[model samples]
Target: MIRPDIRTDWTMEEARAIHALPFADLMHRAQTLHRAHFDPNTIETASLLSIKTGGCPEDCGYCSQSAFHDTGVKATKLMETEEVLAAAQRAKASGAQRFCMGAAWRSPKDRDMDKLCDMVRGVSDLGLETCMTLGMLSPEQVARLKAAGLDFYNHNIDTSPD
Candidate 1:
């Protein structure tokens, strides 16, 4: 069994050993580790709602939504509060434990921020946990979202510090 907290970079010798292992053997080992850490009967599920789509100013190479890419995805305005609430209810009915709202933009605008707070309240009313990934947010914006009952915020550090 692999150590749960080990983060050492494996040398080529270790890499070769792992490669020599059978696929099913590796899967079984991973399954055993996961079951040890979490309940076997626990159903883990999450759903994403694209509240705002496309039109970002960043030049992130991997993202199609970046201003540098011509991925043909049109920039869209933020969805209405009622629309977002309906989606959240559907996610809950589909057995999702959490509903994540994602917006494609550099940072949320004033109107987007207001809509986000309303969305959070709507999601909370459905008894599902709420999370947001709305790009880089100011401390004040963070506090505002928290006040609206947002459970978590995801800020992606897209690349290494180097």
Candidate 2:
């Protein structure tokens, strides 16, 4: 159960109005809203690791990892659980409160779930919060990640189907 207090039914007009607000007005509104739900003085620090980089099939223009683009990024295989754990440990030593693992995938393959789960569990064992951006997930996949102790799922909503 996450953000049960927040409204999810904002109309497109309302959303557009919010987005179109002047920078200062938007900033003030954002801070006001944030303060209502959170301690404004608290800040979070996170270390991001690309567990799997490049060769994404999605044609999202914003990502350099898209295979359709001629980005210099070289595609790599999924990282081992040990490698990810090592990075998490380093992140913890560097004062990172969270570890973010990402993969350049439209959706992770079924075979990759084990490694992903293991990575999450390992990061959590180090006492740091775990987050991942593995693109879309099936219900079963989501359950597995939850079981493995994922604290957050960070998906980029690059566009919305209106």
Candidate 3:
């Protein structure tokens, strides 16, 4: 049986032992735990939009938006606030509960914070959860976004060797 205890200090060996479980047994334990905590049949829907496209300064190997890559993607300026609001509305009409915006930049400039906050507010006003992936954010930017009703900020570490 899977332990019901919640822990934040799992050691590497403990994690490895859990990973080494037989596939069937692992799946059974996972299903059991999932059924105990969540509705297995319910699924959340989210939509992603690239608010600013291409011309990123970061040299991430897997990203086509990197300026170092010869990917045929052309850089475009950030979408206007109304355009983003329309897209969020469309996403909501299509049954999406969350709307995510992405921008191709090393980090958003201080000057752009106002516009980004407007976008967040607009999406939130539409009754959809707002999320963004605008590269590294300063503490001030984070505070502004939080004040604008930003629900999630995605900062994924892509370790692909491609």
**What TM value does model 1 have?**
0.75
Candidate 1: tens digits of C-alpha lDDT, residues 38-122: 9978876889999988888888888987767899888888899999999999999999989999988889987667889999998
By summed lDDT, which 10 consecutive residues of candidate 2 come out lowest? Answer: 153-162
Tell me the whole-model lDDT of each prediction, alpha carbons only.
0.89, 0.94, 0.95
Backbone collision tally, model 1: 0
RMSD of each: 5.1, 1.8, 4.2
Instruction: Give stretches of model 3 more than 4 Å off.
Output: 1-6, 18-33, 158-162
Q: Write one digit per residue (lDDT tens) for candidate 3, span 1-162.
A: 666697878998999999999999999998999989899998889999999999999998888999899999999999999999999999999999999999999999999999999999999999999999999999999999999999999997666656
Tens digit of lDDT per residue, candidate 2, span 55-138? Answer: 999999878999999989999999989999999999999999999999999999999998899999899999999999999999
Where model 1 places Cα greater than 4 Å from the true spot, the runs are 1-37
Query: What's the candidate order when arranged by decreasing lDDT?
Result: 3, 2, 1
**Which residue pairs show backbone clashes in model 3?**
none
Give the range where candidate 3 is weakest over 10 consecutive residues by summed lDDT: 153-162
The better candidate by TM-score, 1 or 2, is 2
TM-score, one value per model? 0.75, 0.92, 0.84
Off by over 4 Å in 2: 1-4, 160-162
